[model samples]
Target chain A: MKIGMMSFAHMHAYSYADSLMKLGNIELVGVFDDDLERGKKVAEKYLTKHFSDQENFLRTEMDAVIICSENTRHKEMVLNAAEAKKHILCEKPIATTIEDAEEMIEACKVNGVILQIAFPVRFSSPIAQLKNLIDNGELGDIVAFRTTNRGQNPGGWFIDKNLSGGGAVLDHTVHMVDIMRWYLGKEITHVDAMVASYFHDIDIDDAGILTLEFENGVIATHDASWSRFAEYPTWGDVTIEVIGTKQTIKVDAYKEHIRMFTSGAKSLSNVFYGNDMDFGLIQDFVECVQKGKEPSITGFDGLKALEVALAAYESSEKNKSINL
Target chain B: MRKIVYKKLEKIDFATTTAKVTIVKSADQLTEGIETFLVDEVNFDSVINDTDKVYIPSTLLNVVNENLYVYYELEQYPFFKKIKEVIVNPKGVLRFRRTGIITENQRLIASDLVVFSAILGEPLTIQVKRTTPAVTPYHTIVTVNFGNGTMAHLEYTFSNDDEKIELEWSGIKQIIEFNSAEMNPFSLKNYTSLPLAYSVDSILATARKADQNVLNRLEEFTSLLSGGVTK
Candidate 1:
């Protein structure tokens, strides 16, 4: 499949771009970035042409486009991509607001193109196996979920609440929320959260703990934050503990690593030897486009996850549970 | 360390995850040679051969469903007890979060509120959320906000033995994690609370049928269940 990448704003764009090169069947058609310099440099590094204009970029011969724009700019890019009759693989927190998310989904549907949201956690092998177990009733009736996706603050436009929608809570909560929804096949009924800018001297929130209820009557909690320091062994962690009628299972997605001690700077670190979840995600997207099948993770899935995350902010500010 | 003295008594029975320790009441309990025990608890004494093991009352063990050493028995639990060895001063805590999946017989929420109240002042507001499976409440989450902008959240669920737990304290610059999976632990330090378990009359009376903390939480859960004003 020929895939063009829109906007290299998100850091994940680099990883996805690398995955694009790794897949033998994929052709990295071109890259379009509003920032001409960064776009040209990325295009040159990947040995592809750089499109300076969105019109010309969309006009390129590409089956799909991966929208890795800023969180606030996702809707505009998705609408443009859909108008151009190109399938889209959009970065998460599909849009900043529910209206934007709904509009994005509607446009893609009207255009009759696949709109897949990027949720790489679902691609982790252990997570996949856990899903299988749940589906097979190996764990019995699903009861509760305890998850965490805490990472170090990725400084930049992320600190700007307008650009990133919010902060750690918005940035981190969507992934696990997507996974939970997929596992239970239910919608979040209510959201209550405690959010604050506790770590860094920033205006946006840096820490948040969310308590959520699902349509299936399962209660869950997620601790999403930019609370890790520089000395932390790895960038962050994505861990989940699922409780069921018969058993409970805990998983640390990034736990398969070797703890290394070096002599010089950056002394202690964990060298991960686990699956590249991004590659798995892109591979799945590529398969969907090649097979002309519906996206495994639809835009509505993205919308539902975003709704919970947005409600979390409202829940914290209002100090009450926000019902969907 | 005060020497723990005990009288020969009926029976002392307790256990960890692996082995079960039973001290039979009579002098004939031990027929073999001197058996040494790395003692941490006491209930009664025995005329068993050698070791100078002190008598500990049964009140010491944090029992759940007749199986001890499951939940946050901070006094002897290696991991949580680490909190005493580490953080000598409990100040400037930004937030606190604790999550546990355990078995509970009562609709009590945050049974261990004393841990939070000890550090962060009295909770300004306690918010309770419970999950009812059929009739019995299977889950409860209590979120407490202190007047000083400090917030603590505790989640508890019933019929789950996944007791590997952790207590977290978010300080200004660092996060303190006191979890069940503690690494190379040091000797437990002396806590200020006198051991009520070792008291003479502790065994005679109903040994902590329910502490004040658990009772208060029970009241809160009760009120919440009845649609009380939730803040």
Candidate 2:
């Protein structure tokens, strides 16, 4: 399969590009990034061609395109990729607005192409085990879910409102939301949030606590934030505790690491040596495209998760529970 | 069995448990020179001025008289007490995001309130979401924002006959986990006749500083657990 990357804006793009090179029977045809220097740098590292013009890049004979532009640009990129008849693996939180998400999903549907959202936490081994436990009724009926996806502030354009849309709430919430919806096969019906800007001196929210109610009467809470300090050992985490009638189980996706006492400024750290979820995600996308199967994590799935995140902001603004 | 999990006890007779105190169910049970009255949380309003000393069982809403003493089970848990000490200072730590608690009983979040207040000062908002309709629910999650502009998320799960409390904050290279053991007796952590005085004062200040809406939500939560209604 021939694949092309739209941009190297989100850091995940680097990991995905690396995965493309390692996987068998796949070729990263080229990379198209508006930022010429960054595009050139990544293409050079990956030993691929770089295209400055997005139209020229999309005109290439590629089966799929991975969209890793900033949050606001995802819609334009996806629409353009769909117009060119290239299958898409768009980053999470599909777009900044609900309308944009709806449009992206519709554009792909009309073009007869698959649009998959990037939710790498769903690719983690522990998360898969939890899903299996729930599916097999090993944990009985799930009653509640407690989750967290917190990371250090990825400053650059991530904190910019126009570029990334919102702060930690937008950046972090969708990953766990996608995981939960995938696990329970239920939709979130309500959202209540306490959004704050405490960690850094930024005007955008650095932290948010979301209280969500599922259609199945399951209550869940998620702490999504960019609140990890500079000296903290690792980046952040995606952890969940599933409360079932028979048993309760907890999964920390980034837990498989060795504790290392560093001589450098970061005094202590956990050296993660687990499944590279990013690779797993790219591998799955490749297989789906190879077999002409619809993407497992569909664009509508992305829209549903984005709805919960957008509701968190609306709930914060309205200061009341938002029924979805 | 000397095991007391302290899950919102409505009729715990401190008189029977302690050596010095006495429970005043009626005038006959009261001693001739009964100077103190041990009362649970709900009856504090009725017996405000009836005694020189009131042994508060679980938690109180507002700051009452100086005679009312708060006995927090958190003081008995060495691990939580150590965390409380760190939270009060928090000089080097940048931020503490979320706290997860699991236990055998849905014990009062009184100690949690104290701990959260120590981190985030006065609570500006309080919201509770529970999983089951069971009076003793299997799961409950609470979100609160303090007057200091910081927020805290706490999740409590009632595991059957097993006790464990796990507090987690992630993404800094290290993930911390705490598993609970049986609590020991309280030590001389405070001054004369005032145990957990700082904590009690902070919780009261939090209550006093909170808006009426926040307090009402807390009241509703207590009522729901006690099989009653609050107007």
Candidate 3:
């Protein structure tokens, strides 16, 4: 199978490229980036072709393409990929707007191509185990979920609203929301949120706390913030506390780590040694496309998560809980 | 220099179980041996039956001081220094809620007494109504209010099947940690490792220094515990 990367706007594109290279019987057709310099640099680093033109990159004999463009650029890229008859594994927050997301999903459907969202946390071992335990009724009935997905603010394009859509609420909320939606097998019915820019002097929000109610009567609270300082052990973390009637299970995605306290560093740093979630996600996408099977995480899953995040922004703006 | 020897009783009927004495010049040695001799050697059942009123021990107060000392030396972490209050809920029920600066040598007496009281197997001071018997499922929440618009939440949940503890410190810098699970009580192989923010050697050296300070504050801590000091 031949897979080409659409853009290197997001950092994960490099990791996904590494995943593609490691897999057997798959060829990394090369990369395409709107920024010619970045495209050339990444292509040179990977020792592959750099297609400066989008049309030429899409016309290349590739079976699938992974889209890691900016949030706002996702729609255009997905539409282009669909028209080119290429299967897509797009990055999360599928698009800046719900309408854009719906259009992307429709375009993929009309083109009869698989559109998988990069929800890599689903591939984490601890998360998979937690889901299994919940499915086995080990936690009786999940009454509520408290989740956090926080990262240090990645400046530049991320802070630019025109490029990245929104701020921490948009960038961070969807991953946990997607996981909860998958775990409960329910849609969020309502959202109440408070977003603030308390941490940074930037124009966009850096912190958000959202409360969501699922159709299955499960209430969840999510803290999506770029609150970690530079000295933090890792870049960020995703933690979920599943509170049930019988028992509670807490899942920390980056828990598999060794804490090292060196003399030079100001604070202790955690060295994580966990399975590469991106590798697992890429492998699944490849296998699904190979077997003509539906993606484990569909584009609609992306749309559902995006809807909740958008609602969170709306709730914060109106200072009232928004019904979904 | 002073030597304080603590004896544990084997049976409630007996006056003492066995007596051991260790001579030390400072409070550091007192703390080092207190855990071994006072906590480990005592027969839990005997201690429960023999004491009618739970008295907060001066040695236990030293432990809290030692903790504060270490925290102070370790960059004066805001979570430790800014703690304005602590609410401990053992067995998933509200037990004691004391409001004051915990790091202050003067304000820790009441809080220290509460911990010492719980360790003695006395029923926790019930501040709120509980639906279930405050037993069986063991869970404790040590919430430390920073008074600076922030707080640290330390929680421990233990059941017959499993045991887990979590600590979350947010604001400025955030740390969310879930401690390792404890499966069997009898198995010496099971151990929960504390995540150290500093190197073990540095911490040990700092601990030695902090122990001396803890000892220096011992008199004041004990005086507060004895209710001899008004403030």
Candidate 4:
């Protein structure tokens, strides 16, 4: 199968290339970047043919396209890709706005092409296990959950409101929302949020907290921020604690249960962690394409996550809970 | 071909923050005894530019350490300043990554800390490698002393074509201790202490959440394992 890349500006664009390369069956036709220099640089690094113009890249005889552009540009790119009848692998936080996300979803549907969001976390072995546990009724019903995905502050176009839409809240919160929907097997009915700019002085919020109530009455709280430093042992983690009617499951990923702290300072001189989910997710995406099945993380899934993020932001702005 | 790998490293613990970079290039591209500061002074550009190449300027870098001040002649010009000489200990390069107060304020970015690995060259394929459990053979575990205490460490064997590989985690220890006088147990050879801190222990919380999420998803895998695709 031939696959083309739409943009390389997004952080995951390189990863998408890496994924496509590892899958083997997919031939990378070419890639385009908004800036020719950056595009060429990325194409060189990934060793793929690159097109300087978007039109030229889209016109390639490719079976699919992966839209790994900025949040705001996703809609137009998706629409353009759909017009070309290319199945899509758009990155998460699919669009900065709900309208754009809806438009992209509709466009993909109308084109009769699969539109998958790049929510690779769902494909992780552990996360897949979590889904199984829920489906098997091991946890019974989720009572309350708290999720977080913090990291060091990021710069570039991500800090610009016009380019990235919102800051940490928009970029980070969407993942939690997506995972929540994935686990709850229900929609997020309402949200109460508190957004802040306590970290670095940027145009957008560097931190945010959201309270979510699922349609099934299960509640959850999420914290998304750029909180890591150069001195901390670990960069970030995503954890969930669900108090279901049956059991309480907690995954302690960073507990170097068997680690050595250097000196009197425990600056995580050495950490024992693994990042195996990436391979599994890529394998699943490739299989989905080969089998003509929808990707594990679909465009509809991407829209649902964005909807929660947008609702949280609107809720934070109004100082009230948003009803979804 | 040039490659980079993280080894037994040491770092400093601060009520504030800092980053210590140790770059050893196979190519003689690096100037010997050069102290480059990658400060995440998030808003440094909007603030001030050092006239002398004394300190490098970056908008995304922060200056969290205050103890050791390395001086260099700033290559001052109309537009930007370049580093002429960086006066570091030559022992290791130090720069601030973040602070406690700064870390406390940034609890909103807890969703994007995922580690997704993929191949760099031809044929175009991607896969999500498990980032936990230190799977043996491919990932090895060793002991590292960060000065006053013990650290359980895991290092992965390098694949032939890994362009960029990173270790990610949630930093949530109450009081971190890294500065040791005698041997300086910190890993001076590598970039240490990539703090992933968040408000109210967001890191561990998120990990637990991810665990549960994964546990729930495992049912599907279990079904596939059981030769049953139908729900």
Residue pairs of candidate 1 with colliding backbone atoms:
B42-B56, B42-B57, B43-B56, B43-B57
DockQ scores for all predicted structures: 0.20, 0.25, 0.07, 0.01
For residues A108-187, write the lDDT of model 1, one tens digit per residue: 99999999999999999889889999999987777778788988899888889788898999999999999899888889
TM-score of 3: 0.65
Q: Between which residue pairs do clashes occur in model 3?
A: none
Q: Write the per-residue lDDT of candidate 2 for residues A1-324, one digit (tens) a residue.
A: 999999999999999988888896788899999999999999999889999999999999999999999999999999999999999999887998999999999999999999999998888999998999999998788898888888899998889999999999999999999988998999999899877676678879887888899999888888888878777888888999887887778899999999999798889998899999999999999999999998989999999999999999999988889999
Task: Arrange candidates, best DockQ first.
Answer: 2, 1, 3, 4
For lDDT, candidate 3 versus 4, the one ahead is 3
Measured with C-alpha atoms, the lDDT of residue A22 in candidate 1 is 93
TM-score of each: 0.79, 0.79, 0.65, 0.58
- Model 1, B1-231: lDDT tens per residue? 111223222111122212223334443343344332223324333322233333332223232221111122333333444564675444322333334343332332333554455556677666666676652225556666666556565766555342334577655556677554343233341221121112222222212323444445445544544562355
**Model 3 lDDT vs. the true structure?**
0.64
Q: Compared with the true structure, what per-residue lDDT tens digits does model 4 show for residues A1-324?
A: 888888877877777688778877778888878688888887888778879778878888988888878778888899998998888888778898878888888998899988888877676556667778988999776665656666667688888888889888888887767877888879988776656665566778776666677777666667677655556566555665454556546553343334557775544543645554556666676677778996778878888888888887887677566888
- Candidate 2 chain B least-lDDT 10 residues: B1-10
Docking class of 3: incorrect
Candidate 2 chain A lDDT trough over 10 residues, lowest sum:
A194-203
